[model samples]
Target: MFFLKIRSIGCAILLSICGQSAWAFHKDVYEPRVPNEILAQEQQVKSPHPVTPERIEAGRRVYFGVGFCVTCHSKDGTGVNLPGHPPRDFTDAKWQKLRTDGELMWVLKNGSPGTGMPIRVGTDITEEDGWNVIQFIRTFGGK
Candidate 1:
């Protein structure tokens, strides 16, 4: 009886793992033009930010409140960690460098489809807010 119980438990665990859906490595799927936002594979779009202190501050407000970026990206934009998904390290200068303003805008508007990032569609969030968030993300380095 004990052996059977152990076997059944193991089978159940295996089934659950196999039955689960796959997690997206990249959050953006709406950027049809980019066609390469498969995070870790290759960047389809670019990141946008003016790298100014003022812009960063404004972005911080949107992120923490209106944008609700904190819920998943976390308070520091370091990204939230979970099973089957890797966390985004906002501090990575290399990653920041590769992103372009246009790409960032696309991500903001459409969001990464498969990832936890929300599309943020039809919201009052202005383009200025998006750019500001970029600035704030740059500050993630915390200089």
Candidate 2:
């Protein structure tokens, strides 16, 4: 009976921690990942590359290939739920509208804080590839 009580308490504590963390992730879905100091400038920044079918296709390749974006964002861009925080749901129209290509690039270059996203551009992909991937991500918004 004592052991059962201890186990129950442990389980309850674990559940509370997990629940709070999940809530935290969902609560900040629309919050800017970029730091406030540079967010405005970043938002104003535009992709040098034009949006063409070819570039979008190339971006798709980067997302699924070297960028390894598919691992977290998933095939459908709905994102996969990981342990600490759920990945961004690219299918979210509001989120797509809220984020800019340059801001996305910033996240790619500098991984999002308090999340699983790692520095991707300089590490695995190039700056151009990052821009291309942003174009590809915009497709998820159906834009």
Candidate 3:
């Protein structure tokens, strides 16, 4: 009886470890990608450029061109299947509502942790292009 109990406990431990590793591969979609230290301040930041048709068009050009966002996110913004963690689904209304432009900009400037995302604003695109692309992203959610 004691041996059976020990075996059960061992199995539980193994399951727990496996579960944690699986969870580590994909981050919670709703969880803020921003670090907690500056999340509040970052959330408050706003885009200097207002949403406009011209700006959205410009953003589209960047997304399809220099941004290289299409390679991973796909043309429809549904995101492609990736190895570690799947890219975010921009079409999700809930996710669109929860995220702010500032937070998106932060992600552009600083690659999201624990995922495949990499920095793009400073390296590939200008800050203005980042904000414009954010506006274009919002369109996927019909916002």
Candidate 4:
């Protein structure tokens, strides 16, 4: 009889801990909106630099090297789900289809605020390199 009571109490404690953690992950976090002007722009606006084999290769290097994209987005761009946040999967065909080159570049340059993505403007990647990275990410969905 005493063992049953102790077990019940332990179960209740475990349930409460799990419930708290679940709630934390679902909590609404405020993310700023991207400007409509930029979002509405055409493909040209997104990637001013022309895409070439060399550019894509350069971007690949950045992804694995300096950009450190593999750390979060993973080598295949399938992304890794952290404790409370899930990384964006670049390999999703539907998701990739909907996004424009400009949007991708914008995200790379400014980074997705309120998320794990950091602003690259002040980082080691230059504007040209950012464009190159965009070129590489486009290949994630297999054009």
Candidate 5:
């Protein structure tokens, strides 16, 4: 009876692994896009700071410093680790092409669901800083 229970547990674990593998391989049907309201907000909401070289530099500082983005996204923004699906590679041409600055801002303001990224909106990150970080991310891989 004990052996049978062990076998059952092993089977359950195998099924769980298989399920997660299937999900990882499964292609997403829904394409991610920023809503019009969010896009409009980017334009309507004036940043206290301008997108100057200094602002970009400041944004870079935040990305590596207080923001702690490098912990996952990596110093180069090329992503790190591959065991459990690596973080998004900001260097990807296709990804850069598909995503907009507003979309990036939206992700910053509201963390990506099911991701390790924490909600940074009301946190230490301010709206202007968020926009600045977006500007910094834009320069990733020379995009």
Candidate 6:
């Protein structure tokens, strides 16, 4: 009878601890921690979807095939780790919110210099293909 009571008490304590932890934690969505004053100074811009079905498809093929986007961007374009650069969470709307279309276009066209991402397939890739790939990238959203 004493053993049963001890076991019951232990189980209740475990459940309580688990319950507290579950409630306290949440997956942090990607939002740039920019100051409100800076945000106020910045201009708002929208990224127009410049991709067509055919181009987007071609880009997808390139991304999954020769472009080797899967290595860094992951198979789903989630932006996995390589070395120096922290992978961009494509699903993060907050991260996406910070970049303009032009900025993203430029990054796609000329890969970031300091980061592990280098100019590779994009040099040969047409502008239309880049746009398509960017559009495809935009689709990954947090559920």
Q: Highest lDDT among the candidates is held by which one?
A: 3
TM-score of each: 0.61, 0.80, 0.82, 0.70, 0.66, 0.57
Full-model lDDT for every candidate: 0.64, 0.88, 0.90, 0.74, 0.70, 0.60
Flag regions of model 3 displaced more than 4 Å: 1-23
| Clashing residue pairs, backbone N/CA/C < 3 A, model 3 | none
Provide the global lDDT of candidate 3 against the true structure.
0.90
lDDT of 5 by residue, 1-143 (tens): 99999999999889878765664556241335345555666534445566799889888988898887888889888977746435677777777776666666777777754445566656868877788887788788444
Clashes of 6: 0
Residue 113, candidate 3: how far off, in angstroms?
1.4
lDDT per residue, candidate 2, 72-104, as tens digits?
Answer: 999999998887778888888999888888889
Index of the highest-TM-score prediction: 3
Model 3 worst lDDT run, 10 consecutive residues: 18-27
Instruction: Please give the range of 10 consecutive residues that has the lowest summed lDDT in model 2.
Output: 18-27
Residue 55: error of model 3 in Å? Answer: 0.1
* Cα lDDT, model 6, residue 39: 37
Clashes of each: 7, 0, 0, 1, 0, 0
Q: How accurate is candidate 1 locally (lDDT)?
A: 0.64
**How well does candidate 4 score on lDDT at residue 113?**
49
User: Each candidate: RMSD to true structure?
Assistant: 8.9, 6.9, 8.3, 10.2, 6.6, 14.5
lDDT of the structure predicted as candidate 5: 0.70
Q: How far is candidate 6 from the true structure (C-alpha RMSD, Å)?
A: 14.5
Model 4: CA > 4 A from native: 1-38, 42-44
lDDT of 1 at 100: 57
- Where's the lowest-lDDT run of ten residues in candidate 5? 27-36
